[model samples]
Target: MSLSKDKGEQNPLEKALAAYIEALQTKPVLTKAVTSGCISAIGSLVSQLIVPNPANGGKIVWRSVAAYAAFGFVVSGPLIHKFYILLDKMMPPKKEKTALDGIKRVVVDRLVFAPPFLLLFLYVITILEGQGHQAAIARIRESFFPVLKLNLQVWTVFQYVNVNYVPPKYRVLFGNALALIWSVFVASKRRKMALANK
Candidate 1:
């Protein structure tokens, strides 16, 4: 039996845990910026189908991607990082592991990180709809609630994956894939509904 631990000696396990924690502490700001940009790009591609009637002419994919990437890089990175730090301070976790301890992380991200994002996304939709006509805007509003519901549901799940499995560095890539899926689903369904109504 190792009596060193008995004497409150910090063994290899304690050392490793401490080191792992310190590594996590060194989060780079750039990582968040990159991640947000990538996800926005994914969303843009998905949104492409919805605008221009995919007819009159315009490159929705590139435009949406550029718009979202800028929003993420310029706006989201700083805001989200600050938001997380604030949550950690206000809702200091008993442990950073999982559960309410974990719940805290998810709640903070969802409650704080999501509202502005949703607003931004809605704004994007508005701009896209506006490009067409008043009728287009009405169509979007009609489809908005259902599409938004799906987007939220998917995002909730993705955020969990992002918070838990993702290191800060790779979070952007993972989130991008998820966002793409959500956008595709929403755009596709909205189109389907529109055609059926026609």
Candidate 2:
């Protein structure tokens, strides 16, 4: 009876994993987008748990988490998925993924995508946190360059491997996996700043 109960409890999770894999196979783009959202949401939750709000007597900020999840779902997911497609179309990878091709991708991505995307991300998050247009603009001014500099420092090395080694279809998934850690860092910093301002 106990053995049966254990199996029953495990079945749902196993089934869900199987279903997710099937979706990845059948609908790669949508699956990757949804996967990005889910991963970002989880990352947000982890950040919130790690950082407490003294304003609310150390309570978790569900609003920030929800906003992070929504941002992932609405902006990061689909936008990133499409961006990868565009990157491939724009650069047209060589017959064999080579070191030079990887370098070219890294250069283009950092130059073209990173700046605008980072600005958009900061703007959206600022707006989502109920700050107005001016605040959003201000946040961008204050934060964008520093964040972009750090982004280059971290992501350049990773993107070489990501672009060169990972297949096109799987690139977004790989990026989202890596961005999971980045999301945690971003969410925690944003939350702390938000709390401090209050």
Report the CA-based lDDT of candidate 2 relative to the real structure. Answer: 0.79
Report the lDDT tens digits of candidate 1 across residue range 56-156: 47456565567677777766665666655565577564534766556667766777667656665556544643454565456556665675566567677
Number of clashes recorded per candidate: 3, 0
In model 1, the runs with Cα more than 4 Å from the true position are 1-27, 49-63, 85-98, 120-152
lDDT of each: 0.62, 0.79
Off by over 4 Å in 2: 1-17, 183-198
Where does candidate 1 have its weakest 10-residue lDDT segment?
1-10
Quick one: RMSD of model 2? 5.5
In the range 52-157, model 2's lDDT, one tens digit per residue, is 6557887777776677777887888788778888888988878876777778988988888889989998999888878889999999999999989999999988
Residue 86's lDDT in candidate 1: 68
> Model 2 residue 155 lDDT?
92
What is the TM-score of each predicted model, taking all chains together? 0.57, 0.80
Best by TM-score: 2
